[model samples]
Target: MNAVEIQTHARKLYDAHGTKALAEAAQMVRELEQRGEKKLVEDWRRIQSALQQMRGPNVS
Candidate 1:
């Protein structure tokens, strides 16, 4: 997916699942990696990164 698509998906996911969206993306990455789906893994990684950015910086 392109950057716009990735951001859109991340937003929808965050809206639907809140904090769990990141975990869902991470799980997708791991499962895709184990399945040897390089392209999907890459996409999921991008999505995961977008999700992380959505969370903003962590505060102590």
Candidate 2:
């Protein structure tokens, strides 16, 4: 998925699963790497981190 799609999907997953969405988002970013799309990997990583942070530190 592109950056926009990744962010959108990540948000949805986050809403449903809370901080667990970080791992799933990371997994998705890795899949994008395997597909050889390096351009947006960093963007997705940042998004994942932000999502995790927004969920708060106590979240697992």
Candidate 2 lDDT over 1-60, as tens digits, reads 665675676677888877577887788799989988787777777778668756767835
Q: What lDDT would each prediction earn against the true structure? A: 0.93, 0.75
Clashing pairs in 2: none
- TM-score of each model, in listed order: 0.93, 0.61
lDDT of 2: 0.75
- Residue 35 alpha-carbon offset, candidate 1, angstroms: 1.2
Off by over 4 Å in 2: 1-10
Q: Which one is best on TM-score?
A: 1
Error of 2 at 13 (Å): 3.2
| Model 2 lowest lDDT segment of ten | 1-10
lDDT per residue, candidate 1, 1-60, as tens digits? 999999999999899999999999998889999999999899888998999999999999
Question: Please, what's the RMSD in Å of model 2?
Answer: 3.8
lDDT winner among the candidates? 1
